[model samples]
Target chain A: MQDDIVLKTEDLTKHYGGVHALDGANFELKKGEHVAIMGDNGAGKSTFVRQITGVEQRTRGKIWLYGKEVNFTGPIDAREAGIETVFQTLALADDLDVPDNLFLGRELTFWNWLGPFRFLDYKAMRQATIAGLEKTAVKIPNIKNTIRNMSGGQRQCVAIARTATFHSRLTIMDEPTAALGVQETEQVENIIRQLKSVGEPLILISHNMRQVMDLVDRIIVFRRGRIVANLKRDETDGQDVVAYITGAKGDDVADVA
Target chain B: MAETSHGTGGLTFDKSKRAWPNELNIFIALILIICIFEALGQLLPYMNGQSLLFDTKGRFDSIFNEARIKIIILQVSIIGIIALGVTQVIIAGGIDLSSGSIVGASAMIAMSFAQTELVNGNPNPKAIFGPWAMDLPAIIPVIVGLLCGMLAGIINGVLIAYTRIPPFIATLGMMVSARGVAKWWSRGNPISFPTEDYAWIGSGMMPVIWFVLLAVLFHIILRYTVYGKHTYAIGSNEDAARMSGIKVARHKVLVYTIAGMLASFAAIILSAKNLTAQSGMGLVYELDAIAMAVIGGVSLAGGRGSIIGTCLGMLIFGVIISGFTYLKLDAFYQEMVKGFIIVAAVVLDQWRQKKAAAKT
Candidate 1:
């Protein structure tokens, strides 16, 4: 929660063949800040995240992570640079058990080279998995169940747990609770609060006004590939936010949004 | 759906601890097929009028019957070797139709170099090879066979990975080209009379032994290794896997190359077993191998299935074929029935997936 400027984008723009997805947009985030990004379905919220997370290359722009200019060719590059994303699709291997899914790529192992053939430190991994689930308050009764067997809420929780475990400098959740029930959504909101309390920077892409207002310190309204209004949580009401999201207001500010 | 728990807790049903009886399911299927055969033997007058699994006549050690079983396993094992790698390919969300063609091509290419120079101390009339290829170490033909497989596999991997061509199309193209090369290798004649050392490679049930051994080895690798996990992950979700820092394209190439090499090795075994290599050696073998993979519970959709399943699938295939022969059914009828079973296996797989998806 040190008020250090951790990430900044300078005239960040992206285009798709001739479609101006993001036109000379600029944004910034300080350390430990929870920022909410809101926009209509066609608006550039996802495109912006894609560019920033290196899921897609920007047609034209510069991105700064940890105040250093960085160009990422792919999401792996972004991840290696300390960016973890919980995409809306919930990219989880449905076939694997919970603990296995938790530590998918970067598995913790003993005996280095012999790790694959060597015995997995199951107790340690299981214990750590349990602790992670507990910390996120994502109760699934059994951690051995595969994601395919779990409820939507549990799957969402597992994806979130991955972010927590990785401890990325910037965590981008693309509508993390889009498919959850009321109770599960509330649980996710609570986890977001826990994230805020720990001073972890998060970029929450959501349409839920109540959740956004309750969770974020600042709201960045995007419309037609432009950041129209950057307002403090108290400055913007849900109605104004909806106006921006739906092109009712802030149309005059910029055609990009 | 029921709630489950873990550790020393009440109502704790750890799903992982509750191992899936996938192998058991396969075993049950095998038994059911055998039971049908037994029932037919009793009902029909011309079924050798005996038990299905055992040779009731007591003419031999039942090892003769066992030998037939071994042969079926042996015949499929060569292709089963290729199927091992193919199972991984299919599990990783791709199909390799070219493996069959790779077998024929690699077999022809390797045998050309395996020809003996002196037939009774004179120049061998049937030799397509130069004198340099004659009397080489046993390792030469084996190495040549393996190299052809490796080369074919690498090409498959490159086309599928780098060019971003669909696996089916790329492998289909390879199928035609490889088979053509097989015919062209010895000008449409069969290559025969390999050295004594080469013959030992596929002597008796060694192909089956190698198949079983490779299946076990690969099964362990798939279950325990990083390569295995990544293969599953990539199959499950390529985008997510890539984002997770797995080199998806490179791994895919490696997988296909391995598959190609396995098919060629199978070819090498086939040549040794038959003592000849004809252009038509591996014709329709791909379909049978794929059928075995499907019957083993390998979802063509990827991200599921096991080597053990495929092995069981091969057994099922063998039993069905054996049943047809025991019943004195026409060879044409058996071929027709086999085609039906392959389609049926796919349908069953689709239905099971639908049911699972519905439940979820």
Candidate 2:
């Protein structure tokens, strides 16, 4: 049963002077589970995700991925360890086309047998990008278009598609559907469901209640930089999560840490 | 983040009125400037009508005034090489102020090695070093100049990338220090009489040849290589690039080093052409090269420049200067007009960016 946990963070904390952006956050995601992190704007939901994804270093924490303790100094370390992230900003180079964005740092290089003479395998990257987008059901008609020329929904889809390219042990999404339309939100939900079906663990940070209820298997509610409730999908409703988030109920912190 | 999401609506771009490539617009601007000069040649109240770019009388080897064209190319080529490196630097979201001084400093050091072993079958009179260092192979001075440039560039890179000194300040410091080194070497005296082989490097149209070759090579690198991608990525948004796992610091260092080496090579060519090395050889060359890059369409804002644009930029620069001289414009007026053109080019660049933004 312990082997099923894909990600676990022990006593994760962050501080900025007198402000505790995140204090003693403890969470876990099981293999094939889809967990939604929910809270108000300043409740440390994004901060908790930041620590696990190595977007920022925690003041103190022990992150265990695949049952081994790891300290990721930066996002690159976490990414190389099979932790893919869809940042709120998407992290795409706006001037580059879709294929270039998809393979920004980890580009496929051909003629590797010739050492420094190795060149970008653009054809291979393009094909792989097409396949990834198709698998995610993203409908980008012109793949050569740069990100600066894309719609909000299309940009979000490209980010999701990029994360889907490799064998990811865990995927962390920060407001993946925040800027999307209703139809696009539904499409993203389908992609998250597919990830669940394929036994890929997920950590989705979202504010949309309806989408969260429809897409997630578990809910972790935060308030005042602390975890207030942990409820299974069938055990709680939107109102119950909101109570925990707003301190109308479940004000006593859960033994989450 | 808001700026990047609104994609360029590719289908709509084709339907819009402004469908020409941006580089084409620059080309048209260059031609328009030529026409303007040609009209001024006819309109000005002078003793007689004259031609700026065309041969008024059949007195040269080419359709154009061969001597004047040669002078324009010779003047632009050395500076154009530096602009190539500056293009990369600006594209990487950094500025280099030391390139001119690097030229000066490297010229002094390299020319010392390029001195001929003999003076009319006697021991060399102007040798900077003992005979052991004199009469060295031509490659020796070329290597020395390039290494001096590389070392200066590495220092600039380290200061900017690792120490977090702002690029302008760091390279500015290098500028002063490098010029100082130039003056210090050979105690403000000029070094001349390079060997035949060394002199041949810059003799008669060779600088122009070298400039064109480097321009093409760098154009390919920026267009098709991973290094180009990373450079654009860094300039476009550095924080985003770092998050994406591109080694931002190392790449920045490499960009500056390459820029340094190019400036050094420019210095070597300058010395070879003049057949001497003076501490003041490359003064203001940095600013000229930057002006060319900016004029060509290498956005100082970074991530949005190209080498071909810089080449065209050099041409525009050359034509404007030569045209001014041809019309017998006062040197003072020429300086003022050149400044005006640089400002106008930047304004045009900003307008294009705004139009692109509005379309999205």
Lowest lDDT sum, 10 consecutive residues, model 1 chain A, at A114-123
Question: Per-residue lDDT for B182 in model 1?
Answer: 88
What digit string (tens of lDDT, one per residue) describes model 1 on residues B203-234?
A: 98788788878999899778767778778887
lDDT of 2 by residue, B142-248 (tens): 99999999999999999999999999999999999999999999999999899999999999999999999999989977877788889889988898788888889
* lDDT minimum window of 10 residues, candidate 2 chain B: B6-15
lDDT of 1 by residue, A63-176 (tens): 888878899998878877888889988878887777778787776666567643443555677777776665555666567776767788778878987777666799999999
Q: How accurate is candidate 1 locally (lDDT)?
A: 0.82
**Which runs in model 2 stand beyond 4 Å of their true positions?**
A1-4, A10-26, A57-62, A67-69, A111-118, A179-200, A252-257, B1-20, B42-49, B56-67, B121-125
- For every candidate, the chain B TM-score is 0.93, 0.92
TM-score (all chains, Cα) for each model:
0.90, 0.90
Each prediction's whole-model lDDT (CA): 0.82, 0.86
Q: Per-residue lDDT for A1-257 in model 2, tens only?
A: 28998998878899978889988878888889999999999999988988887878899878899899889988889999999999888788777778888888888886666442357888898778766765566656467777767777777877887877776789999999887888878767877877777777898999999989998899998888999989998999999988888899987777863
